[model samples]
Target: MRLLALDRFTWRRIYWILLVFLVILITVWWQPNRTFPTGGSLARDSANPQQVKGAIQPIPLSVDLDVEKVALGEELFRDKRLSADNQVSCLSCHHFKRGGADRQTYSVGSGGVPGDINALTVFNAGFNFRFNWNGAYETLEDQIQATLQNPKAMGSQWNEVVEELQATPEYPKLFARAYADGLTAENIKDAIATYIKSLYTPNSRFDQYLKGDEQALTPDEKAGYQLFQDYGCISCHQGMNIGGNMFQRFGVIGDYFDPKDGITQADLGYYNVTKDEADRYVFRVPSLRNVALTAPYMHNGSVETLEEMVKIVAKAQLGRTLSEGDTDLIVQFLKTLTGEYLGGSLEKLALDSDDDITS
Candidate 1:
């Protein structure tokens, strides 16, 4: 009887050990891998094993980049010589203080020509899986090339831009410092792209909440976040940039474009690139970071306010009519997403003359 009791106790101990091992394995597997641009891993919360993980992840506090390249890039970004008319620069549409985008419905390009679609924010653009409203370019380099050649945009030939920059005394020295093979077209693009990559805004209130701060969000904001998930907004708008990781049909539940208003070529979306009928009206989901500050939303920029955009998107995308109270809550939650850039709040740093465009 003594031997049998001892055997039973040993078996019970083995069973408990196996169960504990399984729990640890599952927890590790379930945890999402959060990595910084510099390839560093973010720390996990091991103490609260029971804490539920959300789909959205926080942006890294900082990125590792060459300061010289960043400076050169910034100089190139603001230089008007890249344009055919010498009146427009990258900053013409992508204003740093205006949420990295202009308040204009359709950004004016070279010679005051209006673009077909709205300009997406340059801030946190590095996190996007694809670039532009149509996901036309996979890399920023490719997009920059297209922009340089676009008649309505920069409207300058690569050869012309190279010649113009090479003639400049300051650019030659800047290029020499930033690149080994300096004053080349490729090097110029690389410098500008690197500078744009450094524009990530982190440490938003929502990010603080994600990093284990229980009081970072108010009760109403928490409820709004819950509603955001419940209403399936989290479906396409998941991951680090909140929405830039995937592409989805703008009108998932119903046709968004009105027959009376007529559909333009821009409304065709990715279909214009692939000529695929199935891809019609499909667009890359834009990042919601600093969304409150970037107004006149959507591809055509028809919607002027965040409130109206939310109402239209919920009905058109999810096929659900959100109550006024719920909409207010969601908007409040979105407001918390405005992050800090250069250790200052984007709200405070925004340009007072958001609508005025000198270029």
Candidate 2:
């Protein structure tokens, strides 16, 4: 009688159990379909994983830039008066003549203190999804504010800087031209951001080559380009600027953590902002534009030479070792990405000297 009663109880719960099973089974079976474009050169066998699955269609570059903002942005970019000291301008670290970089392992800030990482070039930074090596700032304006306020960088508080600017006669007029209101922290940030957005250098030899100008790249450069794609460098380093669109870990193939090296406190990369464990050591991939001039590669400025950078990349990303010759070719190809600054007449903003300020 007890067995008969237990059988009935089992049968009563059978429908409930089946319903739960079906829900779980459906969830397991249904995978969301995602799509992306195949990237890199037509001559090479380059295709994204999405392309392999035939879930995405290829799309060409299509977007018009605001020329007025870019023109105004160029002027504001060269203005040294943006800094409290007037000695440390945006161009001070990213000089136009020097391939938009200081070429130092680390940049010297206002008080002669070194920044943690090598200063990235300003060129095509607008193309990046996020700003900074660790992907800390979301926009150029945000980075500008952080840079200005950081004691190591500009070493000036917002209120004090504003008061100084208010005292200056030209700043009020410049602010009027740039923005309607005279000078505020928010407006200053917006104006600076507006100028940075205009700093794109789209036309390059590689761009011409992509547009079917076969002679744009030399024979060696063409070979190097092929090797770059074939060797799987383009998997992460792709898109309009060759890189700077995504984030990846420092040591993907090998464990970056060395207990002996005292690399305590997990870097956590974008995770600090998002709180995702997957973002550890991941950073915004830098633009290859003016790459030849921007030395001391990587987030911590670890790899000094481009050849070492290539080797490290090959080992960490590709999971393969690269020859010295192969590294040289890759470096040579990178050199082609350097574009000339179009803005010739960047007016440097003048500030009153100590005598002028007091007088």
Candidate 3:
């Protein structure tokens, strides 16, 4: 009789579990005409982006950097000896004059091969929590190493790079000055990473405005900032670097990819790293700092102008259409993000580049 009572109790628990599961299933199930959430719920809401929280903060005026290591790294960064071919270097894709990127739709890598994705700006990259569009790398050093070994990029092995750097007349003594191990692979990476970390840009007009300098930004630029928040562009693009702290899907409201264009491996985004079906088009939110200067927007570098890209981002991600005037105001605000490159060498390079172009 006791066993019978226990069985009855077990059956009652199972019945309750089944009932709860059914209720949850019904709650989430959408009607045939009504679609479910695809991450555009915030855009659909009426709240201002600033009111919704997560407004971007100003990048600090200063950061710690290894002075000696940065000097050595800057020289190494321009050395083409790191790539398989003697023609390419880190500077090949990252030109300081062109907004810390090549300004190409897609960068031309080793052997003149076009990269599958856009070459992101290296300016203010130290502020990014993760590296790359896929966020495959958590450290700047890892990203540098990966780039060196990538078949489409440097296409060179560490042993090859080490051999070349050791052969250089200046590199040996420079590395020795910077490290006890001198020219070891790790030391090379450390020096380069140190230099890259020092590439922080600061004191943009927007940052000045953020710091309570009300007169720093023009009236149109201020209005653009408001529209940027109101249009929900600020939802993903917030925090110190403006947008590098999180990952989000490329097209939340509508499909951004054309299957006919032949989706390449780069288009897979975070899926390439995790192999998760849910991560199909997930990407690290890129920093909007210096974005006005970096043209050919999007991962594929398909969008041409800042105005067009703004509209595309609004429609594709937020499921909203913006007027031309609204986009124009936002562009004006974005122009204020082009800050001074604090590194003297980079600033000189920009000036020299301009001089060379005009001469």
Give the number of the best model, judged by lDDT.
1
lDDT tens digits, residue span 205-237, model 3: 888898999999999999998887777777678
What tens-digit string does per-residue lDDT give for candidate 2 at 214-292? 9989988888877787676765677766677777776677766566765523245666667778776676666676676
Itemize residue pairs with steric clashes in candidate 3: none
Candidate 1 local lDDT, 74-143, one digit each (tens): 9989988899899999998898778989887888788877788888999999889999988999999999
Model 3 TM-score, all chains together: 0.84
Which 10-residue window in model 1 sums to the lowest lDDT?
35-44
TM for every model, in the order presented, reads: 0.84, 0.75, 0.84
Which regions in candidate 2 have their CA more than 4 angstroms from the true location?
Answer: 1-76, 264-268, 343-359
lDDT per prediction?
A: 0.84, 0.66, 0.82
| Candidate ordering by TM-score (highest first) | 1, 3, 2
lDDT value for candidate 3?
Answer: 0.82
Please report, as a residue range, the 10-residue window in candidate 2 with the lowest summed lDDT.
Answer: 345-354
Candidate scoring better on lDDT of 2 and 3: 3
Off by over 4 Å in 1: 1-52, 351-359
